[model samples]
Target: MLKLFFRHKWGPALLILLLAALVFFYNLGDISLWDPDEPRGAVIAHEMLQRGDWIHLSYNGHPVTDNPALVKPPLYYWSIALFSALQGHVDEFSARLPSALAGITTAILVFFLGARIFGTKTGFLGGLIFISNHMLFEQARSAEIDMTLTFLITAALFLFYHCYHEHYRPGWLYPAYAALGLAVLAKGPVGVIVPLMIAFLYLLARRDLKAIGKIKLPAGLLIILAVASPWFILEGRAFGAEFFFRQNFERFFHAFDHIQPWYYYFVKLPIHFLPWTLLLPAAVAYWFRRRKEKNPGRTFLLIWFIATFVFFSLSQSKRSLYIVPLYPALSLLVAEALERISSEQNLASLLPWIRGGAAFFALLLVTAGGTAAWLAATRFHDLARPVALLVAAALAGAALLYRMIRKGEGRGIVTAFLVCAFGLELLMAGVVYPSIDVKSRSS
Candidate 1:
């Protein structure tokens, strides 16, 4: 079994493991929904189900009239509502199931796009990085529209990348635009605006204005209207003209959520890309350095990443998950960097700092695991020694893998990344979830 698994292509097997892990962790906890946002979102869907008034969102048996027009579109909430109606009551699993599934599906789409645009190795690395992201996992297990919006926007991005690379088929641009329209429904105008801005900039950068013209704008616009118009029309009829103008247009301009400086995203970027953050500068430099090589795929992805960063940076409201769509691009860039470094005979001399940095992180993980076990034993005696032993074993395994890679293992650095991420995910799903469950029950 082990030989067969190892013989199979690593990408598909890794993806299957990721999906299975996500599904398992997703089902581990009890039905206690997280507070302030997740449960609130679920309740909105539940109220919608009860009242049958999709346009006006209600909370706690009263009309939530504070800033009508549905606040956010109803894609995620509607999905939860449908699921809850079937199940008789919305639980944590039911509310969060859609986002979890969407997250996994998004990873699959990234794999396909990455493979087509770059190579199979790049795709595998990209998918592993995305699924291993702590923020992505957290959002997947919570009831939020952000993950759904990210999924739609990413789908649109995948289609758009293909459309640009392979001559724009009339059929391709339509679905691409249609996905963007659904993104709008999932979040707001940022969906349509972000992709359009990125594509325009990408074409302009490539000096491919003629290719842009082949998009069949009229048909694409109609597709967008077809997918996105009904909700806007219904909401406008239910509310007033202010629904469109204030909620859609003015909100962007006036900083409706909370205004932050232009440098807000700059501050948050490191935390958003934790563990992988150290390698981003090298990745970005590698991307621009290779641009003159006329690599359309890398160029397009870089443009997508930069455009999204700039767009959200300038937005009045900002959040970490807003940048989730950009991670795939970053992952690709990182993978490219790793591949380039690996190919060079003097790789050890060139990237001594990176190698040391990775070793440090691996050591840190081991230290943190030991510290956590000590705390559990001393402060929280309720935790079983068996669980602590499992966690320690996993951490030790990760550290050993890191050491082996440092010593020039048979597998490459990409494999090291895969093993580390896979170990961390297993630790979370296996050891951490059980710990959380025990604490919840005792409380």
Candidate 2:
């Protein structure tokens, strides 16, 4: 039993269990809606439940006046509203459950895609890193559109890769296109724009423009139009010209509400990626070193990462979560780098460097855990000290798991699985649940 549980194929199943446990733990307390965004998103879904007015989104018994009509699609809210209908009230669990599920699904898809593109070890490592990411973990517990957009956009990229490289079936591209369309509904044009930019640049770089001709663009367009048209049509009918001008066009060219300089994402990327950002230089170095290789998968992933970065960097408005879709591509590249480090005889000398990087990350995790404990003790002194201690212990445990990876003494499969599960369980049971309780009471 122990042997079978440690097998490579078991990694994904373990990841699923870890995600489920996290979601369950995060929602154990009385449902709490945090401030502006989460509660606003929840209330919109709640309104959808009460009024049955899916087309016109409202908040606190008033029509939503802030953004353009259909600027943010109704798909996420609709999912939450549907779940709320089943439960009778839109609680934190019901509100953020879809994002949590999507986050897990994204990890699973990354595993499959990585394994298909590289190898099982690479896939496992990539998936582990993805699930362990702080941004993804935080997003999973929040009622935000970014997580949903990440899932859809990643799924679209997966489909696009398969359809372009392996399947070559016209039918397969529909899902890719539909996923993009749904992504647009989830966020906006950035969803469709990012993928298209990546695909185009990838083909261009590979001089595979001829392959683009094989894509049956008419069918893809029809599929996209079908999936994306309903909301636009509804919003147009409901809000008239304002929907088209403000939501459709203005947000892109001009900043409507929260606008920042174009360089905002450049500065934000490092902080958003956190410890993982440290590895990006290594990943990019490996990418350039292998650019001459005729591997389609590597080329595709490289283009995906570059195109996503360029696309977001050029945009007038910027948010950290906007780059979530690029994570899979970046992770795949990092996995490729790690694989080269593990396999190349000459590169074996870099093992110390790899271990050193892991140690650095572990130190960061420990520091963060200590800081969290300090904050909890100082601010929430009313709460039991054991809670903060437990949270700290969990974070330390995650760091220790990374330490084991640095030692390179255990089975890669087992280490990866345990690390992922431990990280997920720790976040869900320790940080997430307690944070929810703290935020709830404070609110």
For 1-443, candidate 2 gives per-residue lDDT tens digits of 64354356666547654754464345432446667677777888998888988987887777665444323677899989987889889887788878877888888888878888887777777876676666766676678889889899889888877887785776778888989889877876667878887878877887889888888777777888788888777766645455545665676678565577878877877676655565555556566666777888887887887788877666666678878888887777777776686677766555555555555666666676677677767786654454465556657655675756656732342354346445545655565566557766877
Q: Indicate which candidate wins on lDDT.
A: 2
Worst 10 residues of 2 by lDDT: 409-418
Q: Which 10-residue window of candidate 1 scores lowest in summed lDDT?
A: 2-11
Across 376-400, the per-residue lDDT of candidate 1 in tens digits comes to 7778776656457655765875567
Off by over 4 Å in 2: 1-25, 28-31, 65-71, 237-244, 369-380, 383-443
Score candidate 1 by TM-score against the native. Answer: 0.86
RMSD of 2: 3.6
Error of 2 at 342 (Å): 2.7
Question: What TM-score, computed on C-alpha atoms, does each candidate reach?
Answer: 0.86, 0.85
